[model samples]
Target: MPQNDRHKEREIPIEFDFYNTLESLPVDNRCTIIMISCGSTTVKINEHIQTVTAPAVLCISQYDNFQCLERTHLSAKVFHFDPWYIKACLNFENLDDSVPIDKQYVYDRNMLYMFTKHHGYFQGIFNLTPQQYIRLNELMLMIGAETYAQSDDYWTCRIRRMLRQALNCIYDIYVDQCKLNFYELSENSNPVTICTDYIHANYRNNISLNFLCELVHLNRTTLNQRFKQQLNCTCIEYLLHYRLKISQELLSNTNLKIDDIANQCGFKYGSYFNRQFTKYLGISPSEFRKNPTGYSVKESRGKP
Candidate 1:
């Protein structure tokens, strides 16, 4: 393939799924697409390769099973997760990578390998050796186990958010290591990582640009400029979205009244909450809860 052909090309968004067939095997290089109907699955990849140990998302247009004996010598584990879950975790639509893929691209988004000709920071963290890949796969499964064990939509969302963060880490590694092409990013800075961590830590509080600037060690203008350039949103806009997302979880999981959920999500009045919720989420809290299995919180005897 020409260097251009090897370049990262975006594709149309397609319906993709994940599956595990380690119990069965494919005759080498037989392309197959694993379909995940729901939930996440993890597999070990033991084939060793000389690559750095970090998380990277992979894109698969097809799937194939590798033939391997059921022996301890095998060297790779492939972790499979619902494509929706992956998409839910990444705001791919708004990502500002130089080689931007179309939102409609249906390529497999795996955390395995990247095309060599593709150059960007996203390539850094996710591409890994078989051993390192196996370890990361195990960690993802543990997270999934904790998520399902809780059996609460609240925890599920939390886990989903965590998965998104993990994927973002892969992308961050890509951004962190790759040469700057379009964005005027700092030479040795991962501002998104810093800003997001701060946001999550103080999400429950009434956080603002001035406060976040102090926390992330950047001035308000620089912070605002960089976040908007990279994430496609201002700091405050992202916070509102984050708070609204939390409120949606609260409304669905708990029997808490609208006002209560609003207060808990940092809003002081039910009316303002209702307006914002309706504006962003496209439904009132009451309307959302009316869905067949909206969100029901079963009080856990203990936290997972």
Candidate 2:
């Protein structure tokens, strides 16, 4: 595959390929990034098998480990690149060239760490938002364009840079990176911290007070107490705020319909989402999206 692209002997050995079929791509020591467009289907990556919803990404680094068990209404794009593509692309570090490719992640901190989050076993799936879906799909096209055209002396660099962004975007899709501090928490994290991290990661899911209790191994009263003491709100209230916080961003930034935004934020029903949003922010989502500054003009949001 690398032969198809502009191959300067000095440039890092990386190949780019695009496939429309939902089946797996063969990777010999290379990392394959599979971009599954907006649709739902069941697929097996190694021993892990689950129904993957639309607009998701899967990064696989093993050979002969991917199979499409079911491909109902599936569309995808796949990119294959050498595992050392990033490490070799680096000229700034005076590091040892003899470092083994598999262990190269030890020297590379963040980039590879994202891929090797669960070492040994392959982690092959990441959830993506609709906005993220559009951005990543575009990035794939750009990577293909640069690799095919060999636009300039820096085409490889451009692909590498955008590749980094795409990787980060899909992996960090649900994670609120602002909550990275949660990662520093000890294995025995406090109930509030555990609950907050779970909420942040699964805000779009059908999360509940009982689910939080089971996740943190605490009773409902104690869990609510911990959240109230630390955040001055109950667990459910915190979840609502997090969802609305996400809704606020989507409303202000994207041209998505209010109903679609509400559903994506886990509101089950659009009317309830509308009522709660209006009650909390003292304005309808449509009104807020239209004039975000309207909230400040109101004397009080809680009042009539």
Candidate 3:
């Protein structure tokens, strides 16, 4: 079989729901796509208010703290996905790399991955046209149906197809409607946003303090100072914690081996990963993986 045609079987991290009202965000704090099929509502996301109307689409991520401030006759289809899902679906089951250069054109609107970076960043909400509403609604129905049924091994691929279509439709309208600030990004970019965004996107990569300093155009001390002033931690500290955060997620949410988890989270060695995890969280990786808790490394500082 051709390499392009060969697909590895695995789980896809996406969810679908029908909501009479979006009283709350997606369960487990996953990223979500809210398709407002009817009525209208206004929501406050991270203190920024935006109104979403019928035949409209809104996307939010785990970081988006949103509340429904007002609503009228709101009914919707909700699609929630893991950050890894966008990568998984697009790459046809390969989870490691972002789109390879050769395979970039394989998926339309590969921007779906970019759209999910930060909650409400890159313009996640859109008002759909009547025709778009009809088409997207049909795709949603197909997605919802397939998600519940899981009729075959190819189920996820089918759902991914519909999802890509839906996101593409949203992107078409979103591009024309929202004046995205890509052109003037340099002016708007900040040290914190730049560094944090890079960490989030490339946590899996082999990253270093020097590389980060060069990437953000800052020296070690100045970068650490900026991070401390705003975030209360140095850049390297933030990267370590971010990797641990992801490792914690994989420990609890996935069945991957501890060694694999370590590698995936960018730890050079399994022993080093275990030592850091134990030192910070007060438990070995294997111990935590076996009997995991919602342990916050900074909050509870793990069990005694």
Candidate 4:
């Protein structure tokens, strides 16, 4: 990785036939960064695998332990996500680890296949051909950049909403082109659809187990078990994490007072909000605002 702007911007170059294993990971506390792979590289993490082609921005957070299982022919450019530079509410400190093709997400092969088939179109987007996975990394960078560049809170929020909608369109194209493998597992009923709506509808309020049970028509036991089994986390965990993520975006992008942000993110009291933010993110809201460029977390706790 090429380090520029004093750890604020970086570039990684991966060459063909290159292989490396990060058996012992580094312990550096820095802000989250965007990586632009310059060439074909295969990355493996336990059973999960990512084969990169074309130039793609790989977002790495301070919260992640990137135990690189294996890699091949990897080269890329990397840049840092400084909250002050971008002026967004998103905390680059937390990273999202949800598997892309799981129940809560719709897998689209069209988007993947398009990149794989016509590698040229995405060549400019990524430095690394034969592009297999395209949307996730690219979209991440797009949102990151847009959030950083836009100052208007309303426009920033609107842009993120549209970006999500665009992601849905990409998913549609992907589903139309390639058959989703996970759909079969959820044939009897699509739990994700119901649960997604429930969370989105009532996330701002105090969403409890009984409430979710009544809303989804599932018992507490079943809901708990299936939620963890399918989505890899409990419902409440997901809700809090999601709320915090949105709050981060709001904090960096808007001039809303801390109390108002707390209320907007479903926290009744600003003190509780401060505690939660500090507990999960290592830094208080005030400190984060003061030095948006500082991206390291004191301890690991939450995901973005």
Q: Best candidate, lDDT-wise?
A: 3
| Model 4 TM-score, 2 decimals | 0.36
Candidate 1's TM-score:
0.35
**Per-residue C-alpha lDDT of model 3 across residues 1-304, encoded as one tens digit per residue:** 0011113444456767777467667345365788899877766666444456688888776555767766767888988766444454343233224545346544542455434444323436666789988999999999888887777767777887787777778766655544655423533246666677666656777878887776556799999898888777778888888899899999999999999999999899999999999988888888888788745576533210
lDDT by residue (tens digit), candidate 2, 177-213? 3255433443324677656766665577787788678
- The lDDT for every candidate, in the order shown, is 0.46, 0.67, 0.69, 0.47
**What are the runs in model 4 whose C-alpha is more than 4 Å off?**
1-189, 293-304
Candidate 2 is scored at a TM of 0.48
Q: Which window of 10 residues has the lowest lDDT sum in candidate 2?
A: 295-304
* List of clashing residue pairs for candidate 2: 39-54
Could you give candidate 4's per-residue lDDT for residues 1-304 as a string of tens digits? 3222222343321111112223332223333323444444433322223334445433333333344422435544333323212223222232122323333222322222222222211211222222333554465455545444544435344444544543354445445433643323433234544455545544566667775565446788888677777766676766777778777877788899988999988888899989988887789998887776665433233232
Which has the better TM-score: candidate 1, or candidate 3?
Answer: 3
Model 1 whole-model lDDT (C-alpha atoms): 0.46
Local distance difference test, candidate 2 = 0.67
RMSD of each: 20.7, 11.1, 17.6, 21.9
Tens-digit lDDT track for model 1 on 1-304?
A: 0111112352212211223433453222121122222222222222211112123233221232223222222223333333444454333232324445554532324332231223223212144445544544655555546433554435445555655554544445454544554223643236655556555544555666775675446788888788777776777777777777777777667898878888877776789888877776567778877872543222221100
RMSD of 1: 20.7
Query: TM-score order of candidates, best first?
Result: 2, 3, 4, 1
Backbone steric clashes in candidate 1, count: 39
